[model samples]
Target: MSRRRVGLTGNEAVALAWKQIRPHVVAAYPITPATQIVERFSEYVAQGEVDTEFVAAESEHSALSACVGAAAAGARVLTATASQGLALMHEVLYIASGLRLPIVMNVANRALSAPINIHGDHSDTMGSRDAGWVQIYARSVQDAYDRTLLAVWVAERARLPVMVCLDGFTLTHSLEPLEVYPDEAVQTFLGEAPTDGYTLLGGEPITVGPLALPDSYMEFRRALAAAMERVPQVLEEGVRAFRAHFGQDLPSLVDARGTEDAEVALVVLGSYADAVEQAALRARVRGQRAGFVRVVTFRPFPTTPLREALGGVREVVVLERADTLSGLGGPLGVEVRAALYDLEVRPRFTDVIFGLGGRELRDEELDNLLRAGPPGGVVYLGVEGSRVLELA
Candidate 1:
């Protein structure tokens, strides 16, 4: 299929892809960054472009709860939210995954509120990391569109919920030209949903919501963990299929740039990696063997792949947009340290927590930060009066 370039915001790209997927049900509440996704989907339903049920949910929690009900009935379901809306739906988020409902969601990654910021950050999704959902991050509008289609396929195949995240405001509201594949391409790539005996029927009664007893609870939890464990293989297959049909190869876990024989590596997730990649390139041009790794998949954590990528490095810096306040560790930093725990020759590592609440991360700043590194300890970029620690 021929792909045509269309200028679209990240949210619009996601909405367009969801339309092609033709979900049976969509329940969403309007929220910053994520509002446009449902708005566009609702328009498609209204225009008869999609023959689907569109439910305008009263609240974010209700929206996710409605999607869970629809998905439990074996309907392909979708929803979107940002920041506190995502937090509000936190309870059902875990339930959706625990029940193995396969709901695909677009999370316009935004900062969680205290004083309240409607802009982009990883805090919202980071807050829900324990919700048992597969999380995928996109760096561009095109990736945002492509990943949404893949998320549905991945979720249903793994029988797990998937969140395709784009940095709110930064990517969500940023306009970019997207190469949208035809509907036939998407259908060909994703194939059809499984016709299992899971759907809710008019007269046929089947028990979906059941009380779990202590006798079977542990077994059920183990099965869910097993399903998540199988996700990497399913995701790789889906990416291959998607590339065959759409001519775009999606990275399932991480994208490595100039890592061969590198002594230092900078690691980041989501859109910020784009900046880091450019910085790495500039560093490389100056005869420094610096490299960058962009993590695309966050949940199930991608430990093995990351450890393999960082094994040869002498120094590493982890750039995180989300913080684990209680632990005094950035989310990505903690995960990176955990991945390197058993390695015999671990690199000097630094945790750089920056770009929170939609603050911009400059390429020059990243280059300078990486250059002046023992690469140990925490540094907060863009924060006033922040001290940079040089660990011995």
Candidate 2:
């Protein structure tokens, strides 16, 4: 398949991929970093390049509510938001998943504001981790494009909503070169949303978002969990299909490098993983066996793959993009430790919480992490105060 190569920011790449998917409905509100995704996609809607219903909702809550209605109505739905905008959509997020509506949303990860920082961070998506959604993190603009297209298939198969998360300014605003498959290839790969799932549209009238009372509440929620349990395999199949169709090789869950006999390892995500990997390579040249793992899937939390990936390392440092505010560790830190808890021999763990609200980690900063070994406990990087968090 001949592909078109173009330079695009993550937001623009998402817009391009969503255009190729050509969803039936898009109800979105503007928020920093994420706003451009819908903005450019709306342009395609206006130009009649795609026949999509573009609804400019009043707020993020209304945006997702509209998505739930559309998805329930059996329309292929899409939306985008970041930070506080996502916080506003908190309630409807689970409702979309609980009702088994496969709504695909693009989240440009950003920090929640008190002092009003409009920068990239995982706080938004991390906070919504338990909302019954499949979260896929992108490592580059190419991934932002590829994952957005693949997410439609994964979400429909999982019978749950999916969030395609990309770094706000890091990838969302920076342009990079990537190949987009021919429109026919994309169409064939996506195929069509399956109709076997429960629906509130077309077929017999079905009561959705029903009052489960006590008797069926757990069952309903359990059904959603059961659906999520099937996502990892479904996603793997989707990746295989995508590879066969587009000849693009992609790791479905976790991307691990140099883990074999690795003495030191760093776990990171999004674009930051690139920097960490480079630092690991540098350490390798200096006679240290270092590696890094990127957790691509966040929601279903691929514990099995992560555990196996970290198992071989003697020392592991979990680099968290968002603070858990627990005074102990960040979200990813807790997850890593929990994943490796039962392993017979696990890597020594250290949590470094940094890069909130778009703090950039220089190559040297990451290099020092491996060279210096574990910091013993939670270390707050890039903070000048040097007082809030103490390294044990």
Candidate 3:
């Protein structure tokens, strides 16, 4: 489990990890940032290194639908896509979770299109937030690989699909040296998927995907909710197991720096956290007592942990890369605010939206944004017709 560096782009790292996991089926269609994932998996299949069925699905919807079939047939299944591709599969996404299928997917976070730009943004995943899947964000190429492996363990254990998210172009195309783990270690950690006569070939003839009446429908949805509620606990256990095998524990809710006594805090998700951390470091050196909280687990939304982390701060800035345009609120910002609503001593909260359509954000820009915002206010970063100085 000792660390050794080997350079790789985030997509390459995920592909390598998928190979190690040895899923029974892979159904994918090409999309930027995510295309490399399926391409590398296809190569593995061609080389006979992987024993899985690689289905070149016609569309994103088909890819997920295929995964649904494979998973229901009691096969370990995987798929990868982004943006519109993810959007197309939106319906099946809910089905994957509601049916309690243990399919694992890699979502290369990207902006959805009318003008059609393919770059890193949370729009794709954020749009599908209610699909009843557990989502985990990756900050680096190494994280991409490690999380993909963990996603399988979490999904199968909980019998719910899991989305392993990576910032498009940031980690997807960015190269970094990563330590590749041995296959045997991975197998030991993930263990064998449970089998109970759910297999397609099993003679017991079990039924799946049947219509549910109003009485049973609510109960099924409740079951899905209960499974999601169990994710945080299972995630903690998964991290412990991963640490035992890989020697590096992944943070579940918040990754913190200088938060113990900080008066001002920046809360963000995904690769943006790297910039926020740098800004926080500079602020700390200047005796500003600033820190950051990175949301690694998005779907069961980590409300309790976030509230505890930001509760003592005098000022809290919620930075989001995705916009909830219909509601005119940043998705992460709105969620963070909701989490703090019941606290007696809530921090001064601000919403700062930046880095949309893959807009680049520098550390200095983050520092300035933090400085410009007032306590208990929402500030739009990098917006036209706004008084805030444009840092780009």
Candidate 4:
């Protein structure tokens, strides 16, 4: 039950977790922000620290395709990517998830390029939301490590692929104090490399990812949906096991802070939630009753918990780092509003889009925005001129 406190970047911490699990195979291509994860783990492979088959594929698409093959053949698999790398793997993402391969991936969330920015945003992962993989966002280095381990167990139990996303440059590269658990603790919690159900090797002949025409296609999809419905239950079981083994709590889905008695709540995801929490405290000092909720698990959308967290609040502002360009608002804004739709007395909700392509929002600006309460319409924080978007 011993833990070590050390300084490591989010990428390093995640790699350490992979090292502890020592999966049967890891297939990845180097990409910005996320490159270091595979880069560092490659070192582990060279040193023979773990008996893993490290495959350095030529491209992201090839990397993921390799992972799908390995996972289908009953080998525990993992991979890493960001931005366009993830976009390139678009087709395979569905293949991996659709086949219910328990292939875990670490995504360094980055803004997709047009101007070729190599910084943090939710665009990369959010774009793949409908691909059917379970998505978990990490807010800190320790979160990146702990959740990566949790994702492995969750993926195997659910027989679905999982993505552990950390903000690209922000968390992936930033050094922070992290508490790392012993290898035995992680191994015991995750169990051996799940050889029973995942076996595609030396087993009865089976068709993997077989063609399903109209009539049968919908049924297969419905089964996938059923698996998604069971994620919350599986996630809770993993959280409880993690807490019992490591003596640390991993709050499932969303993490709520100071929302019980507050009148204003700021909802956000990833490392930026810390900024909102700080602003909330500052607003509270001015007697504004502000609080912040960080959405840790994005996929399968934590509707019930989110509704309960903001149940008492009068105003809720959803701050999304990506534009999502839905012609409506950001993805998170739409989800939040819909989740609270059934409430008897709904809070005044506003969507504030910010930090696209890695734009930074100053602390004073964030505090001022929170203190001022929900704006009249869609506000684009930190963009030049015209903060609110008035759709004609």
Candidate 5:
């Protein structure tokens, strides 16, 4: 249970935690921000520090394909990617989850390109929102490291793949202090590598990824959907077991701060959480009752806490780094609104899409927003065409 402070970037933290867990296979390719994770892990493989099968895949698609294959063969598998790299792996992402492979992937969240710029954003992960993976975001380097370990525990238990995501350059490259668990404690937390007779490595022969004809295709899809419904429960059990071993509890999937008695709440996610939380505190200094809600587990959507976080607030300001152009608001905003759609006593919602493609948010942006009170609909931050686009 001894913990010591160590300095590490998000990518290094993921690589370090993953190395400790020692997955059976790692399928990797070099992608910005995310590359450091696989590259650092590769050093361990070369140095004989880890007994992992390192697959130097040709492309992101090949990387995930290799993970699917390894995991299908009952290997604890892992991989890392971001941005278009994730886009390239899009097809196989579904297959990994469809076949019920418990592969743990680290996505250094980045902006998907048409303009060909590479930096941090949630566009990559947001695009795959329905890819049937349990997506969880980390707010800092320590969270990135801890969450990476937790993802493995959760994925193996649920037999569902998990994506531990971090902001591309912001967190991925920024070094910070974090406490790492001792190796023995980590093993105790994870328990034995799970093998519940649903793999190719088992004695009984089994086939995976068979093409389902029309009669069974719908049923297969339903099974996957139903499996996702079990994620919240799996997450609950996983966190409980983790807390019992570590003596420190992981916060629930969604975290609420200053919300117990507040008229305004800010809903946000990812690496910018600290800033948003500070914005909430600053609001309090000005005699405004402000609070903030952060999404930790993005998939299965954490509906319960999200609804409770905004329960009695009179207005909500949702700050998202990624925007959904086709929708009424940003991705997180749309989801937050959907979570409380049927509830009668819900706060008014405002969606603000900011900091896309590593865009620099103005120094006073958060302070100004807190001072101005919650606006209505989609507000694009720091753009030249500056105008509030009303929700459609």
Candidate 6:
């Protein structure tokens, strides 16, 4: 297996990975932050670098619809979008997953509109969290590239749509050095596109996406839930294969650091976790038992791994970019708290909300926050006006 080190933005890295995968179809609508991914992949299509049908759909909905159709027809399929574009695909997001189509999508995570901000945040993907897709977040250009490829494998094996999310401009536009594996190595690792599932092109009479009556609808939903439960096993299998073939150690679904014996831990997702980790490291050098965990896989929510990581910690701070708007902290805070609720010696947890609409989490600010320890409830950091919102 050969490898080359190269400089690329997160979007370019993802596009290059797709080129190597050479899926049968890519249907997408260009959107800010995420547009460059499809733009670069389209160039690959035009230059004949890969034999793929590129469909420039009129809207994000149409783009994902095309991908759903192609995937249902037994073609390997993918697409890219962000913010409003991803919101537009919300309805079809469930359709793809309900039909169990192995469609993979890349989302340059961006803030949703109301005041029309186009910056990076987890709001877009977290908004569509219940749409039944395998959600994976990346912290760097290399993570974006490797995880996009990993998402494809997980999607196919789990028979569910996978969303590979990277921070909008933060990761998508920032340049970084990454290792590129040989095409044959990647191809050999992924093997062939799955063909055992139901397909429209199978040349047999079959009912696809039929309306299930009230009696059977519950069963269908239960089956989808069961499929999600089985994904951790399938995802772990792919990670092992990828490690063996590419000699690259990808982060586990729950990427924990310094938490094995640390007394304080911060739980976060996407690139923001990198900042928290750096601060935690400094705190450790200063004799503070501080640690942080980056959640790589958000969907199916890695409850078991998280429990193991935070089980013995004395205090936990969950910092999230998007608010749950429930006056109960953020989406991740709610989930993490629930995940650790049953622990025998539960940590004193606090929810720190920050980085909404691409707000930067500065190192000094994070350093200050880490030194303060857990506040024992919900606190708003870096936001003006109201600083702390105490939850009853």
Candidate 2, residues 1-392, lDDT tens digits: the string is: 89999989899999999999989999999999898999999999889999999999999999999999999888899999999999999999889888888899999999898878989989999989999999999999999899998999998888889999999999999999989888888899988877764677666888778788999899888878888888899999999999999898888889999997798888997889888888889999999998889899988989999988888778888887898888768998888889998989977888988898888776766766666667768888767764322221
lDDT of each: 0.88, 0.88, 0.87, 0.90, 0.88, 0.90
lDDT, candidate 4, 131-229, per-residue tens: 999999998999999999999999999989999999988999999999989998888998876666535684577678878999799999999999998
Question: For residues 125-210, what per-residue lDDT tens digits would candidate 1 score against the true structure?
Answer: 99988789999999899889989999988999999999999999888999999999998888877777774875675357877757
TM-score of 2: 0.97
Task: After superposing candidate 6 on the true structure, give the runs of residues whose Cα lies further than 4 Å from its correct spot.
Answer: 386-392
Q: Write the per-residue lDDT of candidate 3 for residues 76-190, one digit (tens) a residue.
A: 9999999999999999999999999999999999998977889888999999898999999998888889999999998988899999999999989999999888888998988
For model 3, the stretches where C-alpha displacement exceeds 4 angstroms are 2-4, 373-376, 390-392
TM-score of each: 0.97, 0.97, 0.97, 0.97, 0.96, 0.97
Per-residue error for 174 in candidate 6, Å, reads 0.6
Candidate 6 residue-wise lDDT, 1-392, digit = tens: 67899999999999999999989999999999999999999999999999999999999999999998899899999899999999999999999999999999999999998879999988899999999999999989999999988988899989999999999999999999999999998889888998975688886867779989998999999999999999989989989988998998987588998999898998989988778888889999989998789999999899999999999999999988888889888899999999999999999988988887888877766777766556778887777663342111
Over 4 Å off in model 4, which ranges?
195-198, 388-392
User: What would the per-residue lDDT of candidate 5 be over residues 238-308, giving only the tens digit for each residue?
Assistant: 88887887766777488899888988998888988898998889889989999988899999798888888
List candidate 5 stretches off by more than 4 Å: 387-392
- lDDT-wise, the better of 1 and 6 is 6
List ranges where model 1 is wrong by over 4 Å: 202-204, 389-392
Alpha-carbon shift of residue 377 in model 6 (angstroms): 1.8
